[model samples]
Target: MVPTMVLVADGTRDTRRKEALHDLAEAVADRREAPVQAAFGSPTELRAAVESIEGPLVVVPAFLAGSDAASTELLAGLDLDSRFDACATAPLGAVPSIVAQLVTRLHAEGWRPGDGVVLAADGGPELPGNSERRQVIDVARMLSRRVQTPVQVGYLHAWAPSVSDAVARLRRNGHDRVAVATWQLVDGADLHRLREIGATAVTAPFGPSPVVIDTLLAQHRAATARLAA
Candidate 1:
C-alpha cells in the first residue's frame, strides 16, 4: 500500500501562510491514493499524526532545509517506532526543483540576467550541525549558475550579511539592479523584510508551486522504493 504522509511544517500565526500549507497538503493528497495530512507544531502533534495511521507512513518536512534534524529528534521521541512502519524523508531544500523555483520566481518578478542577486532564506543556526547553512549555500551556488550571475547568501537572521547588507555589497560592486530571490515555502515576515530591504526586486514564496509538489512526490517515491528494496 502507498504510505500515509504527514507533512510537518513550522506553525505560523499568519492565516494565509497556514492556509497555504494546508493547500499544499490538499494538493498532494489529490494526486495520491494514500492519505496525506499536514501537521503544524510540536513533537506531540507529530507523534499523534503517525500513531493513528496504519501500515507504512512517511513524514515529509515542509521546511526548505534543516528539517532532517527535527525529523530525527521527533522520530526518536515517538514510542510508535515499533507500532507502525514509519520513516522521515529529507527536507524539501535537498531537492533541485526548489532551487529551480527560486529562479522561476525571480524571472517572474522581472529579475533579469545582469542584475546582482541575493538568495534570501530564513536564517539557520551558526552552531551545531549547521545543515541549513550548508543547504542554503548550495542553493545560492545553483541559482548563480542558472542565472549566470553571482548570488550572495543573505540570511534573514542569525548570520552575517543581512539582506540589506548583501544588497549593499552588490551596489558597491556596481550592480544597481539587485534582485532578492526568496527560498521560502510560504509568505511570512522574512519575505516582508526581503522586500523592504532595498532590493530592486523580490520574489514571492513558493507556496505550493508545481515544482514543490513535484519535490514532495519525488521524495515519497524514493522513500517507498528504498523500503521495497
Candidate 2:
C-alpha cells in the first residue's frame, strides 16, 4: 500500500480560511484519486492526523513560504518510533507553477504591459528580521519578469511601505495604472485590507485553483519518487 499524503496549513481564526483549506484538500484528493487529508491548527493537530493514518505518510506544508517554524515543529512532533514511515515535503510556493497563476490573476485584473504591480503579503512580526519581506520581494521580481513591468513588494504589517505606499510610489513614478497581486494562499483580513489600498485593481489570493492543485500533486509525486529511489 502506498503512503497517503497529508496537507497541513497554519490554522486560522477565520472560518472561511479553514473551509477553503478543507475544500482544497478534498479537491487534491479527488484529482489525484488517492488518500489526501488536510490538517489545520497547531503542530499537535497535524501530528495526530499523521499518526492516525496507516502505512507510509508524506506531510506537505500548504504554506506559501517554504517551511516555517510551524512546519518544523510539526515534523518534530511526529513519532519517529512509530512503525509507519513518514516524511515531510516542501511548501507549495516553492513550485514555479504559481508564477503562471500570478500572471493569470494579474491579467484578469486588467493589468497592462506598463502597469505597475505590487505584490502584497502579510508579514508577521513574529518572524525574524526581513525574512518574509525578502521572500515577497523575490516573488515580486519573478512577477516583474513575467509581466515585463516593475513589481514592488509591500507588507500588510511589520514592514515598511504598506501596499498603499507601493501603489503611491508607482503612481508617483508616472505609471497611470497600478495593481495589487496578493501572495496569499487563502482569503483573510489582510486580503480585504489590500482592496482598500487604493490600487487601480486588486487580484484575488491564490486559492484552490488548478495550478495549486497540480503543484501539490507534483510535490507529492516528487516526494514519493525520492522515497522509492
Candidate 3:
C-alpha cells in the first residue's frame, strides 16, 4: 500500500521553525524502510497532500501533548471528511518511548543522580487544555523516577511556577545543581527562555531522534493495523 506520513504542527511564520520541521520530516522519511512520503504543515495543508496522494495515509501529530488545541483542531477538521483513508495516532508526548529519550538526553548532558531537573514547556493561559500541562508533569515524574532526581514542572509562558521559579524552588530545596529538560519539538521562544533561566544545564528538544522516529513509525503501523482489522 502506498502510505504517507503527515506530520502536523502549529502553523508558524518563523523560518527557523519551518526549517526544523522540514529537517525532522526528512530524517523520519530516511529512516523509514518502506517507501514513505513525509509531509509537514497545518491540518489543511496536510489534508491537501493526503487527498492528492494515492493510497492510505497515517497522520502523526508532532505535538508533545495529546491535548494540544492545534493538533486536536487539526484532527477534528480531518474527521469531518471521509473521502480519504487516513488515521491519526496520539501525540508524541503520549508515547512511552519519549521518557527513554528524555533520560538519554539528560544523561548525555552530564546529569547526575541527585541533580534537580525541571521539565520546561511553553505552558500558560493562552494554550487550551490543562491536559497538556498535566502531560508535562507526567513526563517530569517519569524522569524523576528514571534518574532518581527531583523533577518539577515549569512554564515559559502563562503558567505558574516559571522556569526560573522552578530553579529557585529547587535551589531552596537544597539542590545545588539544577538542569532543564525542554519539552519542545523545535527551537523557539520557549527554548530561548529555557536557556536564560539560569539552569546549570539545559537539554535540547527531541528533534528527529531515532527513538522519536521509531515511535512515529510505530504510530503509523498501529493505525494501519487497525485499518486492516
Give the top-scoring candidate (lDDT). 1
Estimate the TM-score for candidate 3.
Answer: 0.85
Ranking under TM-score, best-scoring first? 1, 2, 3
**Candidate 3's residue-wise lDDT over 114-218, tens digit each?**
899988876644333436666777777787888887788877666778789999999999989998887877665556667887898899988888887787788
Q: Is candidate 1 or candidate 2 better by lDDT?
A: 1
Prediction RMSDs, each to the true structure = 2.7, 3.1, 2.8
Off by over 4 Å in 1: 66-84, 126-130
State each model's CA lDDT, in order.
0.74, 0.73, 0.73
Q: Candidate 1's residue-wise lDDT over 40-148, tens digit each? A: 6568787677777778877787767732233334434545457436777757664666777778888888998799999876664454444677887888888888899
Error of 2 at 184 (Å): 1.4
The alpha-carbon lDDT assigned to residue 65 of candidate 2 equals 64
What TM-score, computed on C-alpha atoms, does each candidate reach? 0.88, 0.85, 0.85
- Score residue 54 of candidate 1 by CA lDDT: 72
lDDT at position 85, candidate 1: 66
Q: Which is the winner by lDDT between candidate 2 and candidate 3?
A: 2
Error of 3 at 84 (Å): 6.1
Evaluated at residue 80, the lDDT of candidate 1 is 41
